[model samples]
Target: MAKYSEKASKKVEQAIHTEKEGKLRTGTGKKVTSRKQAIAIGLSEARKEGAKVPQKKD
Candidate 1:
């Protein structure tokens, strides 16, 4: 796997944790149902925070 910044990893961890707790949600306020979705949400948040995440694919 590609190396991620510490902050980026932390964000993903937090998101996974929240998902496991059944507290993760989407923009439409729908409950999160997939691991990939959670990670994507985490990376999106990290990007918004200007963390050292890799650029998203087009």
Candidate 2:
């Protein structure tokens, strides 16, 4: 597995907390109703910013 940077981890952590509190929202205004979705969003953002390596699908 590839390692995520501290910044990336922090974003994901915040998203997880927000998801747990039912306050997570995506950039397009959609609510993050699932933990997995929130984490995916964070990871995608990190990838976009070049803060973390993206996972390759098998």
The best candidate by lDDT is: 1
Give lDDT: candidate 2, residue 15: 77
- Per-residue lDDT, model 2, residue 26, is 86
TM-scores, each model vs. reference: 0.92, 0.69
Clashing pairs in 1: none
Clashes of 2: 0
lDDT of 2 by residue, 1-58 (tens): 6787988998888779888898888889978888889888778777778785557457
Q: For model 2, name the residue pairs that clash.
A: none
Candidate 2 lDDT at 12 equals 85
lDDT string, candidate 1, 1-58, tens digits: 6667889999999999999999999999999999999999999999999998888999
Superposition error at 33 for model 1 (Å)? 0.6
User: How many clashing pairs per prediction, in order?
Assistant: 0, 0
Worst 10 residues of 1 by lDDT: 1-10
Model 2 lowest lDDT segment of ten: 48-57
Q: After superposition, how far is residue 5 of candidate 2 from its true place, in Å?
A: 1.1
